[model samples]
Target: MKSKIKAAFNPRTWWPKAKDGMHNMSPLVAFFLLNLFLVWIKTYINYLVNFNLGVTGPIQNFLLVLNPIPTAIMLLSIGLYFRGKLSYWLIWIFNLIQSLWLFANILYYREFTDFLSFGIMGSGSATGNNLGKSIAAIIHPTDYLVFLDLVIILVFLLLRKIKIDRKGIQKRYAILTILLGLILVFVDFGIANVDRDGLLDRSFDNNYIVKYLGLNEYALFNANQTYQQSNTRKKAGPKDLQKIQQFVKENHSPANVSYYGTEKGKNVFVIHLESFQQFLIDYKVDGQEVTPNLNAFYHDQHTKSFDNFYNQVGQGKTSDAEMMQENSLFGLNSGSAMVKYGASNTFESMPGILGQMGYTSAAFHGDVATFWNRNNTYKSFGYNYFFSKEFYPNANKPSYNVGYGLKDKIFLKDTAQYLQQLPQPFYAKLITVTNHYPYDLDKENISFPATKTGDNTVDGYVQTAHYLDQAFGELMDYLKKAGLYDNSMFVLYGDHFGISENHQPAIAQLLGKDKVTDYDLGEFQKVPFMIHSSDLDGGIDHTYGGEIDMMPTLLDLLGVPTNNMTIFGHDLLSAQNPQIVVFRKGGWVTPKYMKYNNHYYDTQTGEELYLSKDKELAKEAKANDAYADKVLSDSDKVITGDLLRFDKRTDFHKVNKKNYDYSKKATLKALKRSQETNPSSVLAKNDGHSTTDEYTTDAPEYSSSSK
Candidate 1:
């Protein structure tokens, strides 16, 4: 009876015994440790995604407290359960694999592309070396921490193998390790869920942890508040709708305008020149000019060049520009909204609108349709056909350049031919790539006269711009020869400002300036949006406008009714109060000579801009933020395939019952269908392929470095 009592009281009777400190560790403990490590890595990555430390303030303290506890417990438990095996070579291998995975995740978080070759061997500021240096700097601390953590873990495991040996000691150590691990697990799970409810709420904390260490609780709270605010849309009163109806009726009424040859039946030719800036127009070399053809063409055509246009280039860059121009949507602050919401096909795009209006919509580009997940977007947007590099057999394949595809000249030529062949009254969107980076035009092949020397990138861009201009001229000439010039309307704009400092600096040098300052820099993004016709009286309308305004403006010109759509832009030809051109940099520069950059600015003096005491700016900011949120949330739906089931027959009664008007709900439903049916509709020109094929190519490969 005394022996039985002694055995029951002994630690070895109930707990697993080991001679060394790590002997009692289990496989389950190891598995838990691995998962905890993964969670920590995920949390770190989330931080990078949420805030640019250079931009946003450091994450709150509470969030950092949530990650390490689980990991410590799991590690301790594993060490106890597998004390004998933990010292084996397999443990080392496991640690090595985990370290590699951590490194890979960090690289992925930094968006390092394996396919792209950096020209680090080059001898220029824009060289691959310089670009690589910049990228390294941006991803430094986070990547280094991952490496350091891996090294530390490896060393700790190695030390454990060497320090412990006796069987009796291992048994005692394992029991202690298990006890400690259990305590930690309880504390971690308890603290983590103290104020949280269910998995969704807990998941929000995970997301928050990604944004900042020790700030998950604060992030969760903020996110919840934001979510609530986002779902609440201000009801557009009857008076507001009536005002919009009246505005549309007055200017777009078919009988009110001059009956020019440019009519509703005319085909539309739109060109989105990649990184084509207005700087090219004035750039000169020696005694000759950089873009003589463009300069002359702009002068010849009835061009409406804005002296103060700005680009809102967001995280998506070219894709964002495409979204703004085609769908009249705003650029999102949270990553790539197109990729996020692309699956559901939510927005009613220009192609779809044109398609409904009996226009055979087509898109043309010099690169692969899959480059930006454009193939899916184009189809979703209602394009009848897409002509990419794959379709252009006669394209010149250049060497040394990373982005090899058809030249803009060939693209333009093929596009013109295709437009002519297509059934009449078509809408053709032509995207040019000649001005894109790694600008590698040979001097011998340059058709334009050169004025600059030494700067190859600038020279190449100038040459390409010249070629594009010539192509544009030729297309215009073809239209005239085909008797389509008078009837068709052509709109040309740049996708964004040129990414080349060499090109920008060359232009500055030509203009006898160090840098193109202030409003001029803004105008650099503002390319010429020309509308030329032999019959319509051509004159510049000095009304302020933006890419977002393009859709409504075009619809207005064509006498089409834009029913119940929430567009961020207004028609330039109409009296729609003061105009505001918002930049992706969060600047709100108005045509009324007001410049805002998170704060207000006086355009003339370049002073810090501020809101009125009555919170006018705050109200506007809130509205804009809400709008941006909606765009992102809606896009999320598209990317996740939430809108795939939506059809014309889908009832909007429930949505309308929530206080959102029937028209608004119907518009949302239509947008969802568009996203589901044409995932790449907003940016990529579709070829009317199967929906399955569209989604299959929806995964986009982003460039490793900023051009």
Candidate 2:
């Protein structure tokens, strides 16, 4: 019995033993470590291939490299509970899931430029069917390396080179493995916290969460967050709505009568300039205008432009901008509004509100409706029509797209026919995508030489912005030829900043600044907001506001009172209230002072304020900072509580989703009904001929074909 007990704890003669002071690991534990080593290798390869991981510096790479230690220990501890086939298969399945999960995310991130969230994965069969070839095209040959461990293990088992250990690991050893895993986890947390304070709490950006804690931890965090939001919505009280409405009412800014009803009863055309910035309005590269057409539109006699308009975006970026502009509510402080609560939230949106004003609203985009989960969001917005990629011809071809979807020229031109089919005084929005990230262009489409900046992305931005500008020129010509230009309320706005702080050095050359200052970063956030109407007076307004201000401004300009609505933004044209633009991160911009990341700066001088020297400015900054934080918290309470559902506004008409459908049959039926009722309809007057063929451009894809 003594010999047998000795043999149970001893390593086999043929087994490799550790040096002094190191414990001899069991074979099962060794196997788990080996498998996890391969997983680490797979993860490193994935990070290398995935450009959007945006991994920089040695510390980040080191954190990712350290992931396998805790992971292997945890799995081994769990597997030790059973022996033989049960244990073997359990570990195998764990490895399989880990590998496959990474592979799937590699494909998903390539298309969406984001990590796959549990919310999107639960989006059901419609989303799966819509994936199409886009997901498949992004898979790399080396991506198959992730499954190599499975193949090797299968081969060994089939060749009888290895056998499953039937004996369970000793309890002490199993407990040791679990304790080791816990220790490693604590170590990881310490290291991560050293790098970024409250790493888990500041998970508003998924990448930040992944950077400090690791992908596995991020998945768990996301699941918890999603559950919390779901629970919050279920338990919400009517008091939530009362508080929100009261807050908005106290903060409301009455409109300027000068701009009120300026373009009332006119058709509304909202064109979203994707990834565009205000600096490109009249900027030149090598003496060539980068965006001449947009500059011309900005200076046009009837255009109302904002020189100080900022983009208020959170983790959702462009989608967040849409949420703010349409709903007049801030997006969730974390995750995307479109993905997190789009299907469930009760939105008093632009389209739905306009529908009550006898306006038929439609949305146009050249990507799948599920790209940002826009399809369901649009329906909830009470849109009469949604023209996604399915509505455009040849949108699936590679030649028609660069990054996200169809090129601007083709998207706008193809959309012309559908636009004319809408009833008079309709509301339509065109979302452009040519100037998106990793901006690449075909040589034939490139009109200007690349900027001399060393950064390729900066140089590419100049070229792509020019291309989109040229497309805008074609769209203008088409609208004029169709007699829809002068009569419409044309609103063109840049959705967000094209370049981030990482690209600031390259842009510094353009700004003629030796070093990028806080002022420069603040200025970079400015986006163009142009409202053009033929009969209205127009000029640049120096109002400090954000995307949230747009909805109230539009409603006010259309002669609608927003006294009963729940809106977070004040009208830019209203001087009754001080215009304060609150950023998502608790910073704020006001005309007198700018508070950013606990620092106060003078708005006019662009200099940091010394608290001792500028006591008055510091006091104002503290107040503004507190207000900004309150705004973010209040916005979260409203969205998470789904408070709008309890709104008691007598003028508000809740969107009836059952009444809307995006199917071709539904769109055709609506158009047919419009023609039957209104003889003055554009499509009926034109005898159903396509008005898009009139659009002429120098673009290589369409120039010769159309002319």
Best by TM-score: 2
Candidate 1, residue 310: how far the Cα is off, in Å: 3.3
lDDT (tens digit, per residue) of candidate 2 on 536-613: 788888888888899989988988888788888888888785778887744678887776544567877789776668
lDDT of each: 0.49, 0.77
lDDT of 1 by residue, 1-707 (tens): 99976865564554334457543643334433564465455445644452322122222234344443333433434434443444433344544444454454344333321101111111122223323433443354655554564466566656763333222223444455556656654554454455332323322112233323222232334455444433423322345434433443442312223421234776787878777776677666555566665566455545544444456655455777787777766544333444434433445677777776666677787666555556666655666667766555555444311243566555655555445445557788888776665455655446666445455445566666766666566565655655566667777777776533214466566556676543434444565555444444445555556676677667666666544444555655555424666555434555544433233445555554345553765576555544433333343333233232232322111111122111324433643454455444322233433222111110012122311
The segments of candidate 1 whose C-alpha lies over 4 angstroms from its true place after superposition are 1-262, 285-288, 331-347, 395-404, 446-463, 481-483, 500-528, 535-543, 583-587, 592-600, 610-707
| Candidate 2 local distance difference test against the native | 0.77
C-alpha RMSD between model 2 and the true structure: 5.9
User: What are the C-alpha RMSDs, in order, of all predicted structures?
Assistant: 13.2, 5.9
**Model 2, residue pairs in steric clash:** none
The reply for model 2, stretches above 4 Å from the true place, is 1-116, 120-169, 176-216, 333-335, 394-398, 500-522, 585-588, 592-626, 683-694, 703-707
On lDDT, the leading prediction is: 2
